[model samples]
Target: MSKNSSTATGTSVSSRILLDAVTKHYPGQSKPAVDGITLEIPAGKIVMLVGPSGCGKTTTLKMINRLIEPTEGRITLGDEDVTNIDGDQLRRRMGYVIQAGGLFPHMTVAANIAIVPKMLGWSKEKIKNRVDELLELVSLEPAMYRDRYPRELSGGQQQRVGVARALAADPPVLLMDEPFGAVDPITRQRLQDELLRIQEEVQKTIVFVTHDFDEAVKLGDWIVVFSEGAHIVQYDTPERILNEPASSFVEDFIGAGAGLKQLTLNRVRDVELAEAVTGSPGEMAQDVLARVKEAGDGHAVILDENRRPLSWPSRRQLSRLETIPATPDAAIPLVTQGSTLSDALDTMLVSSAGAALVTDRRRSFVGVITVEVVMEAITRSRKASAMANDNDSPVGTNTGTIEVQGGTT
Candidate 1:
């Protein structure tokens, strides 16, 4: 997502990790929580560990921190043996967020966020600066929320503050355990979007735990699917898992309607459409006739030099109305290059707009997304999904992670 990084998957050499013959055992159980798991995690990648409850997915992740020490095997962080490092020091260098926004009962949001920096011996001024910065990073106003106590905030706010706290020190290695799981579904989605945004800004090495396959697919650079006792069933990109489904277990986990789900993930650019309708407000009503004749479908997008939309004036607007009203805000959402065809459909549904005014990021209209375009995008997405499933293609780099200036790590 960073401008400097061509690979949006967030990979870098410094954050790579490796697990060699990793195994963990509980005191009373004869079976291991983790059983001989060997995995390679490229740096700056988010590898999601997902499965049903008590599947040992969480246990396998915790072993990276010695939270649950491995009874056998080596854990390496960028070629350094993490097993030899002190647990506290190792944890301090790793950003961690839990589902509940684990704030101290007695601390203000600012203080809660400052805990890690304070532990790492940051000056008071530095910690204050970071607290304010993180609040903004998480889309919260620092002045109104920083001094507030955890009890005074909503669950969503609490979660944001917790994320601010975890990211305070800008550690390269991040561990998240169902970090958005505690909030309501709507709030959880917002949090997920925010996480994706922040992850783009900060290209950290992330190992995340989740029970939800959708969440894993949405966030993972690569997903590591596990069975009971931390046995790996499959490890690959989200697209690959969905399309290829290494085994019946993985396919069954995705369930039906996967084609629809995959549609949301692919972008419009993945497919193409016919030239769209175009027109001008003041153009000779007769000119509309010639243009409509040329387009064959009987329409043309009216454009200003800037290409901001004016209207999709019906032939009725010209024939029935005395004058066409040109209002900028009245038009549908200005669809951008980054938006998926699915996004265009969503905007159309919400606005009841017959077409999307497709634009460049600069807001200059490039083309339009008409009913034809929408249908084409959907058809293309479904076809791609089917092909991907047939070939087991990897679902990597489906998103754009925009870097925020001055983002740490």
Candidate 2:
């Protein structure tokens, strides 16, 4: 059977998901798999549940959509109790994703993404439009991938399709359980970055479960750290969790260098980027070199007509050569304004350029990010973290339920 699209209308609506004293127990098990756990997942934000294996993290997540019913306590979607709701109906209101995409082996990618919309009786034209939108949302080109089966795609591509499927219905809430766990480390990191990018636009209340603290820190707006038996050790923002662990249990769980980890929260836009010499194709090599020398960076970034980055010209080509190469086609890495300092560092390292061109949403040139710039931002953030009060209240705990209102593509 093919997966179904979400039945939710394609609107940007979200509700604060609440788990009040949530507990789960097996028939023969003496102790509860998930002990008394009360946590508030704010609307339109990512809440990560992280801990060791068998820590009940996954069980807690499943309980939200009632995939695995809790033996005691109430789960609320906004102000409505989910425990008393119809299982099928409740699931239709939320999107669920698991490891390895969990796509139907027999279905094409478009079919998998359209399943929920079709089940909800969406018109063929509407479903088709949504399939294309979601594929683009997840960075999968719709025209290229819509007809492909799961077997034909790589693990990362399949995971993207799975994400596209989950978002097909535009559900207000999304539950992900180790969704990127099965991919290679590099692919996993890219997925994490992509997820953050998607969240910025969709703003669904996301509950993500992962064992990797790094992933948790990277993606979580707020994090709930679970100990043995699903007991909560700490529930707070990523910054608070990194800067101030609630207890020794939390401190131990978070491990060392918490401050360093906090750098991921700081974005490239937060720091001052250095001005770089820039030129367009067909510019005189002598002119470009003169500008580069004036800027004292000894390098020039060439831009296209749309102001998007093209390549970094070699200092040798500029300083000792003739007119700029007519077919300038060298590789230069790029980072967006929303890119975190950690992401910038990764780009620099991978590109071996020690610097990356930063751009805005319109793909226009913004500035450049270097390792030194990232380091400065981190140093400033660390000092701020040190002076910040650990007792300050966390973000997104404003109320039991947040009323989210916006438009959805």
Candidate 3:
């Protein structure tokens, strides 16, 4: 395949997008909407432009595709100057997604996705293949959704269609402006997960614009905190920004739950898990009790023949039991290694058990995490952050593509 062409079903080759002192000024506005902003959006990673409303995040994004022209400075895609490129051709080569999908009311899902491919004069066979590929890419069943109109789908499903449509021609860069903002919180989270999954496969150079700092932290490989006039307050990986705020405004923008938010970046695998005593279903109550006693914890996690978690017998029942309960309730919440610390905490809260059973990707028993363990982990993290703040440079900050530079927004 040619360097410019993408595979039929996977990640496309991507190129870096750069802006040098890019500024946008509306004719009547006294001050520029976006002023003297210089940023390099790295290839094959999601770069988020986030700030409060009227901060010029959207204006900065529109300038990349020439939807809103830059008044000063220059924009470049790889080695080519965007100012010198034809607007129509430039846009077609880059995918654009907006809120609520912006789908045509009259168009079917397949037709919506096929719009770009059709415009590019692809053969009917190629367009059909591309439509099927994208529908599955976004977790929608191609056979069921292909012929359905946008109105027939749910809000979340429609948004998926919008993503599919944007990716129809396999553009190397994707520009998304609040694409998941219209859905409910639950749906929005699902959409975020879907986007992450899709990115793993497509590897598009994605520029996402949002007002929510949590969303930015969750989605961005590198985050650009924008203030008024598109001024960049901080440009760095989420970890450094959370641990070391460049200014008072950034710390305030990060808000009160900064430490807890940072926990989301650390997965369950980051912590050393405590081993829980386990027993087979047919094991005698005395044997199980002995194993639990040896571990110095009164709790025991029962496992089935397949090594899957079965239950955590209540303390009251365990006290008087002569034999292991055959029908023990499997009320213990289970979490995978890939789950975040925040995710484990949520499960513990929901189950009211103060603990979560961890499992491998294959669903086999691994270990458990208690409330005490989580608290200790948080304390350790805080101390580390405090130490890092007191000292000079932090680890993993100097050489990465996204550097934390000192500047005002």
Task: Please tell me which predicted candidate would have the highest TM-score against the true structure.
Answer: 2
- lDDT agreement of model 2 with the native: 0.78
> lDDT per residue, candidate 3, 1-409, as tens digits?
1111101111222478878778788899999998777777778889888888999999989999999999988888877898999998899889999999999989999999999889899999999999999998887889999999988999999999999999999988899999999998656755776787688788889999998888888788888887888777777778877877767788888999887887767767788898888876767777788777777876888888778888876545466677765564645677767666766777788788899888865468899977787777788778887887688774333235454444453
Q: Is candidate 1 or candidate 2 better by TM-score?
A: 2
Give all candidates' CA lDDT scores: 0.72, 0.78, 0.79
Estimated TM-score per prediction?
0.71, 0.81, 0.75
Q: How far out, in Å, is residue 226 in model 3?
A: 1.2
lDDT-better candidate, 1 vs 3 = 3
Assess the local accuracy of residue 102 in candidate 3 as a C-alpha lDDT between 0 and 100. 94
Give one digit per residue, the lDDT tens place, for model 2 in 20-93. 77779999998889876666677888889898889899998999998899998888888889988999889988
Q: How many clashing residue pairs are found in candidate 1?
A: 9
The sequence of per-residue lDDT tens digits that candidate 1 reaches over residues 85-156 is 999999888888888898997999999999889999999999999999999988898999999999999899
Better of 2 and 3 by TM-score: 2
Ten-residue region with minimum lDDT total, candidate 1: 400-409
Clashes of 3: 0
Q: What local lDDT does model 2 show for residue 243?
A: 67
